[model samples]
Target: MELFTVKSIGKVCVDKKGTRLKLDKEYIPALTNLEGFSYINILWWFDQCDHSDSRSKLIEKSPYKDSPEMLGTFATRSPERPNPIALTCANITYIEAENGVVGLAYMDAEHGTPILDIKPYTPSLDRVENPSMPQWCASWPKNVETSGDYDWSKVFNF
Candidate 1:
């Protein structure tokens, strides 16, 4: 088994929920300018997370502590697993390094998390149709409801 060494980690920032991190988008234009690429694949470490001890342990429960029966960690995006890391496909809305900023939407990562890597999100090679998602993701549960209001302090402890 060969291991790859990373060159560096990019900008660190938290998620809107204040529980996760987001990476810098400043490399996109430079990517397009140099490599003619538009989109990217973002690999980030859920750094604030301490999942090493629980990495081998699997759980079926939802992070919110609600929902239904136990589902495998891989079956659920519980953020608990062999590696407490996550990736997402995002559209690079824009990158303004002159101002030292990058903008991305629909990002689920939190602030200050280390950005492991970024690769162009190539749709030509990456697009798929009707991907099979988990059962819990199919529809809204009848019994599940939300009070809506959320307090970050109570939900996440640093």
Candidate 2:
């Protein structure tokens, strides 16, 4: 097997104020010109799930309310997988370039989670006009904009 090394450019901070991505001083310059974009794709590490056991998990019982009985790790967004990496498209509330802080409306990651990378959310390259999905999830929100108001509780299995 091949090996790779990944370093965190920042960490996620969540508090009463809300979520924020605090980049390392070295990564501050990279945030320049990142403003103006309404959204961004945050690639982060699943710190809590970075265990050997989690990495070995390749399949999972369906985590959705009305999905198949079982699913491969790639099929579901579960953090338990070969590589504990997560990608989330977050709304950019504000960007403090000097402080190297990027305010976020929300992120599925926990506080202190390591940020792998960040990229502007360009619809031309990231958006899919009419992509197909399984019937079970077809009723889900069509876009990230509507996902905020969506009653996700009805879709996720507890």
Candidate 3:
């Protein structure tokens, strides 16, 4: 695979339900200057994940065993994996900052976690229909039911 240099890395602070996360004020100046960007691609490092576990090297059952049968890390969204990286598409509500510190959207990542990269979420290019998922997720529950509340706080902090 080709490697791309990362411009900056940031933490994805999400609530329990996996929604809105807190961004540092330092990022405010850069993200705020842009307009017409309603959504963004969140690239984060799953620092909390134990990459040392050999089991995380390849893949296995859902980290939460009760959720599904065994599967590959690439196949599932489970945080356990070799790279321990997580990516998500989030809607950008608005940018907030004081004194041009630098804060972006609130996401479901932890503080201090490395932000691999941030790109404009282009609907025309990113959105795909009927993409291949996995058998375990064949009948995946709705976001609200699976993770529960779709509220911003719950979604990003979880």
Candidate 4:
């Protein structure tokens, strides 16, 4: 088997002050020109779920109330995958390019979560039009903007 090394470039900071991505000093240069983006796709580590038991979980017992009784790990966005990684598209509120700090309107990540990578959200490559999904989630929001007001509790069974 081939081995690869992954390093954390920064961490997601969710506090009373605000939600932001605090990049390490060494990665400050990488933030150059990122301000032009209105949104960013954040790849982060699910640190809390990085355990032997979590990693070994291959099936989930219906995370959605209206979904199938059993779902493969990949079918749902549960943190208990073989690799505890997560991705979220967050709206950019502000950016301090020089200081490597980025403020966001909202992010699904929790406080102190390690950020693996950040990519600008370009419509050309990121947007999906007329995408199909399971009937259970068909009533979900159509776009990211409207998703903020969506009643997520109705979908999640937890």
Give each model's whole-structure lDDT: 0.54, 0.95, 0.57, 0.93
TM-score of 4: 0.96
Quickly count the clashes in candidate 2: 0
TM-score for each predicted model, relative to the true structure:
0.61, 0.98, 0.61, 0.96
If the candidates were sorted by their lDDT against the true structure, best first, what order would they fall in? Answer: 2, 4, 3, 1
Write the candidate numbers in order of decreasing TM-score: 2, 4, 3, 1
Error of 1 at 145 (Å): 23
Please list the residue runs of candidate 1 whose C-alpha ends up more than 4 Å from where it truly belongs after superposition.
1-8, 14-38, 63-68, 97-101, 140-158
Weakest lDDT window of 10 consecutive positions for candidate 3: 148-157
lDDT of 2 by residue, 44-157 (tens): 999999999999999888989889999999998899999999999999999999999999999999999999999999999999999999999999999998998999899887
CA deviation > 4 Å runs, candidate 4: none
Q: Per-residue lDDT for 25-49 in model 3, tens only?
A: 5665556554577777777777778
Residue-pair clashes per prediction, in order, are 14, 0, 31, 0
Higher-TM-score candidate among 2 and 4?
A: 2
Give the Cα-based TM-score of candidate 3 against the true structure.
0.61
Candidate 2 RMSD computed on C-alpha atoms after optimal superposition onto the true structure: 0.7
lDDT of 1 at 75: 68
The true-versus-predicted C-alpha distance at residue 158 of model 4, in Å, is 2.9
Q: What lDDT tens digits, residue by residue, belong to model 1 across residues 1-158?
A: 57756533565554553222233455434433423444556787666555566676587454432345566787665566777777876555565544434466446776555677766766678776556644544443321122123343343222
Weakest lDDT window of 10 consecutive positions for candidate 2: 58-67
Which ranges in model 3 have alpha carbons more than 4 Å from their true place? Answer: 1-8, 12-33, 54-56, 63-68, 97-106, 141-158
